[model samples]
Target: MAFEEAKIRFKGSISPVITPFEEDESIDFKLFKRLIDWHIESGSHGISVTGTSGEPSSLTIEERELVMETAMKTVDGRVPFLPGTGSVNHRETLRLTKAAQEMGADGAMVIVPYYNKPNQQALYNHFKTVAKSVDIPIILYNIPGRTAVNLEVDTIARLAEDCPNIIGIKESNKDFEHVNRVLLKCGRDFNLYSGIELLCYPMLAIGGAGHISATANVAPRQVAEIYNAWAEGDVTRAQHMHFAMMPLNDVLFRDTNPAPVKAALGMMGKIKPVLRKPMELPSKEIQQEIRETLMQYALVL
Candidate 1:
């Protein structure tokens, strides 16, 4: 599909799948492929790997590239394959993004430079350089809580104006006003995805594209249903799914990211609850909470 046509199709629940690991802390390619196929079968509009949920920062460049290759190969153009290719290092970001383009990925999600706290101009330069380098669509990831820096709305609009391929953004911040401002400034056609799970329905309600959420890892059908409901003009059903998903969303983030999500996946017997170093399984208390929440949704018995 042409990039233009693909942008329209990208406006739905895109699952940022967790990178499953073995007990030895190696990437579980077997489990990873299974998760991708499951997401597609479960109704995820698209599949993303190596995002925050996938623990991109923990994996090496080679490992990240391998994950992207695996996702693209598994997806096989069944649904859009968007891989998170950003890093704190610009060179590494460019390398992975270039690889994504060459590997036939539909688009790439590049995160804001974390820890360094680059100013708005520096952020612009970073994205502009990458967008210029790659031919595929670019989705800027703005998670101030994790990155310690916000991609200001003006800077976002500027990037959209300056780089045509810098087409969309994943607004992970809690501030809904940022979502409004991006749409107002960048135009309604600019694909704005809500990375915050709770904001998914609201984002779609406001002329935004869709969500690239971690919660979708456990509830892909529900999450995709929310978007499908809204698209079909069933506001009532959409709202129901939105609120129904709240508890699961909360539990998934009870700890730091994919830990809770990975745990839930294990409980469902989809994959083993394993994470790389510095990211162990969720605590016993949180694991129980996750189980209770999933039971409420009947995801686990």
Candidate 2:
């Protein structure tokens, strides 16, 4: 779809899918494809690969590109495919984003440069350069907890004004005011997606486009339904779904990110629970918590 069409269709629960790996830490393309199809079958509005939940930092550029390729090919226009193509290194970010554009991805989620801690001006230049380089829609990802530098509202507004393709932001910060300012300054047309699970419903209530959630990796139906309920004018049902997902969302982050989420997927027989180096499986206690939580939700036996 064209950027104009994609901007409208990119709303709702877009799963930042976990990158399934084999026992020896090899990318499991076969299982990865299955997960893509499963997300679609389970009502995910879109699929996002290689984001935080997908372990982008661990994967090589080639691996990240391959995951994007697999995701696009498997999705095959069934729904929008947005692959995370950001990195601490601008060159790598450009390379991955260029690949996504070439492969026909609907949009690209470029993260704020991590660890380097660029100031507002530097951040502006970094995003502006990338946005100029790509013809596809660029969704800025601001997770200061991970990236160590917040993409300030003014900086975001500047990019929105300067780069038409720099269309949206995935605000993962806990502060709702930041999200408000971005939308306020950038205008309602600039897409905003909640990266925080608990804030997903609230974000939508405040005019966010949708969410790109890790919890959706295991509960695609519930995540998607939150948006569906709200959109269908069932505020009561939407609120209920949001609260119902609280326990599961807590467990998914009991440990660091994809570890807990991947383990949950493994327990549900969706994929192997292997993780790359420096990112191990969740602890036994955490695993027990996950199992009990899933069981409580009837996500497992």
Candidate 3:
């Protein structure tokens, strides 16, 4: 697809797919592709991998590229592949992002440099440089909760103004006022996406293009239905889906993401809930909560 077409299509419930691992810690490419196919067949709007949900930090650079390559081939252009290609290291971020572009991804989502804590000006330069490195559409990822530093609204506006390819952002922030300001400053057409599950509907209500929600990994159809219902002008149906998903959303985040999410998938017999070392499975309490919630959703018997 052309850049404009891909940018326009890069909306709705884009599932940030998880990277399934075997008990021996090898990447389960087969199960991973199955999950991607499941998301598409179940009506998810798009597919993404190697973001927070996919445990990109755990994968080697080559592995991330392989995942991106595998995902695009599996998708076969049915949906846009918007993979996270950012790392704290600038060179690695550029390299992976360029790789994603070469692999024909619809867009590349690059997170703010974490741990290093660069100021706003530094943030602008970082994003501008990455956006220029390749012609692929760039979606800025701002998750202040994990990254320690927020990509202030001014910096976001600056990047949007400076880089034509820097088209959108995935805001995982909880501050309502801040997000509102982002729309006003960056312009309503700025393809804003809510990375936070609770704010998905609210973000769309304010003219957001869509979301990169992790919850979509478990409840793909329901999540996409929220966007589909709203897009079809059924506000009531969209709101119902929003509320219906609240319970599942809460339980999934009962522990740090991906953990609870991965465990839930394991219970559904999708893949083993194995995480890399230092990032273990959710606690037993969290697991029980996930199990019960999955039952409530009828995702598992």
Candidate 4:
């Protein structure tokens, strides 16, 4: 699809889902399928596999393909499927984006190039080039903390203006000012999905489309509920729900992303808290804290 066409087709709350592994520490397709079913059943608008939360860095190309294939087959058109296609190198990124489109993914979440920290012109050209390379819509993922370089508002506005395929951004910076600026600079065609879970309600109030949240991995229904209620103008209900989730969100990141999320999932008896090497399980103390919070929220065993 053309950029203009893709823009119209993509927008909403999507989770950067966790990849589950069996006791042998391989991608566990059964538990993976169950996790997918849980997300869709809990009303997640879409799932972005092989993302940060999915430990894309740890996954090989074949492993990524397995997760994407399983997610597409499981969701099966019930919800949009978005897979992470960001890499530091352009050629690799294009290969993945094209792969995502070929595998019947609805869209691709392309994060800003990390490590090398390209200048503004390079950033613009990078996204434009990859976006032009594929038929699918491309949502820019700009979480500077992870990537090091931030996508500038002016450049982002320009990208949205020039590249019709560059539809939206997941602003994970946790800076509401930045989110507001993006909303102001780009207007409605350029959707801004909150990358940070805690800011979803506030972001929505300022015209953000929704979230690409990590917290959704543990409490899909609770996080999705805030968006649903806020959209319907139920501010009181939304605020209550948002407040209730702060501790849960904090716990998910107490270790570092998917570790805490995977640990929490294990505690819930949903999946084993298995992560790839170099990323260990959260400490027992952290696990206790997560359990206590889950108890407080009444979300545990």
Worst 10 residues of 1 by lDDT: 1-10
Please write out the lDDT profile of model 2 over residues 76-99, one tens digit for every residue: 999988899999999999899999
RMSD of 3: 0.9
lDDT of 2: 0.93
Of the two candidates 2 and 4, the one with more favorable lDDT, higher being better, is 2
Candidate 3 lDDT over 1-301, as tens digits, reads 5545655789898999999999999999999999999999999888899999999889999999999999999999898788999998899999999999888888899998889999898888889999999998999999998899999999899998889888889999999888899999998878899998999999999999898898988999999999999999999999999999999999999888889999999999999999997799988888998999999999999
RMSD of candidates 1 onward, in order: 0.8, 0.9, 0.9, 1.6
Candidates in order, TM-scores: namely 0.98, 0.98, 0.98, 0.95
Q: Give the whole-model CA lDDT for all candidates, comma-separated.
A: 0.93, 0.93, 0.92, 0.85
The residue pairs in collision within model 3 are none
Write the residue-wise lDDT of candidate 4 on 1-301 in tens digits. 5656555445456877899988878989898888888998998878888888999888887777778888889888888788998888788798889989898888899989889999999999999999889877888999898899999999999888887777899888977888888978988767788888788878878877788899999888888888888878999998998888888888878888889889888889999889999998999999899898888877885
Q: Runs in model 1 with CA error above 4 Å?
A: none
User: Can you give the lDDT of residue 286 in candidate 3?
Assistant: 80
Question: In candidate 1, residue 257 scores what lDDT?
Answer: 91
